[model samples]
Target: MPLNASLPRRDAPFKLGATALLLVDMQRIWLEPGLDPDHADWGPDHYFYRQTREVAIPNQQALLRAARASGVEVLHTIIQSLTEDGRDRSLDHKLTPIHIPPSLEAGLPPKRLAPVGDEILLPKTSSGVFNSTNLDYLLKNLSIEHLVVAGILTDQCVDMTVRDGADRGYLVTCVADACAAPTPERHSGALKAFGGYCWVAEAAEVVARFEALGRDAAA
Candidate 1:
């Protein structure tokens, strides 16, 4: 994905009071090449690095800035096991053919940019953030009913989280450019699969809509 300068202006501002931004799996394990020294080495040929650098990070940064300026609560969703022994991880992580670790110390940490302000970090042991964390509780407490989602591994964690958010009745807007997958095909497929459940847009468009909301409030 490239930087989209043509941002769409909403006809009217959305209910900004009920909106929040959820950034999922934007951690070092996925974003940084050598964060996990023990993991398989990735070179310039790695699709993950190229997509993240060329597409996701920049878009995510734009969304974060816009959300902060618009006063939309910003939250991060990360995958982490509750126990060192991986007992709290999902069956897929515990089983073969898909063994995922539950610790960030070795493979995870926010990579491109650090969380500032009072942004809350929600940890989960499963693909869906809501399934393993108190994300629902936090959203309810904050009265957040609309969510703008962006992050890495668009085909996995982000997809699952979006589905969960939709099922819980939140109006979701997925920033396509701010998300990445192992391949372009997988990324596009994931977005298409969940397109019906959420309003998908580029980061620039989402940022424009958010800023438009601010303008409406000022007016």
Candidate 2:
């Protein structure tokens, strides 16, 4: 069968990577609202990306707990303009104006350097992690195979990372309950679209897998 952008294989359970969690885009800016037609439902406090702030936040946190217990590396890829001139952001970000420059220009907001201590916060100008970042080198050095992805804007960042991971010879497991689009409909839609591309599992399932693995590893 031909590869469908909207379909993923339903046969195998995802093979875990070196056990790395590739978290994308949790900047205060991406969390902001826009009035663009594409973001008609987006507004400050409108709950457009509510699943992220509400559902995914807690779920991802629980996954993080499992990750730590399992000794999995956690990395964050946040989208931001590298320059005030906005040379990095695509026309989509530029036109959509999801965030004004300087705010997302890598200095201000909460996208500060790699979550302060152990977390590696990566800022990307593009959608895919391997597009220009050292993510490839980093993952390779760590011998990463399957990437457990969780983050905001499901159809965009989550989709891209899953696609790129598959292309780069890594298995991808996307925590569906721990993900969210700009809206609920799109969030669910992205899950359906990630069908053939990613092994979509609930956050609780991911945690359960890790816990079970931990017990097995100990035994």
Candidate 3:
């Protein structure tokens, strides 16, 4: 089957608040060949997965453009320990197994706390956003009420961020098309689980929403 053919297409118009599009852990290490999922002992069907080798990039690019045009805030989060000496990881970081393909121990470059200027990018050590990062403070200070999410590891970072955002009373939407993982099953499963805490929308739905908001603002 054509990889993305099974995905839903969305084109709805909705208003956007002072929303932020949070990009979670879409690092090169996660997408590039240097990080090999096959090494994880998964079968050929399970190895390297399809999302990175196929979909995701286009959806993310579209979301990025729409976010910039609509002037919605963009936030990024990455999982990286504080120091090479392991001081930043806390006991939790050390205790966590480093068997994952793109984990800190997998030689994935520790999240650099991207110097994004006005855009907020929080550095985290764990899967959950609020569990380790000051993202709560950043959101409250920005006075943001809505969150639009995109990034890699839909079953992990993206999933955790949306869950936390919703728990804290933010309007959370996950760009289902923009997130990547090793396989479609894992990606879809995460979307289903996070649906309780998020509105799982396609990239098109978010873009249309942003554009509609712009039109309403001008009208």
Which number leads on TM-score? 1
Candidate 1 C-alpha error for residue 43, in Å? 1.3
What RMSD does each model have against the real structure? 6.7, 5.3, 8.4
Candidate 2 worst ten-residue window by lDDT: 105-114
Candidate 2 lDDT over 142-173, as tens digits, reads 88776789887788878888888878877788
Candidate no. 3 TM-score: 0.77
Q: How many clashes does each candidate structure show, in the order listed?
A: 0, 7, 0
Clashing pairs in 1: none
- The better-scoring model by lDDT among 1 and 2 is 1
The lDDT, on a scale of 0 to 1, for candidate 3 is 0.69
Task: Please identify which of the two predictions, 1 or 2, would achieve the higher TM-score against the true structure.
Answer: 1
Per-model CA lDDT versus the true structure? 0.78, 0.70, 0.69
Q: Which stretches of model 2 miss by more than 4 angstroms? A: 1-17, 32-45, 88-116, 216-219
Quantify how close model 2 is to the true structure by its C-alpha RMSD in Å: 5.3
lDDT score, residue 56, model 1?
A: 88
Q: What is the lDDT of residue 191 in candidate 2?
A: 81
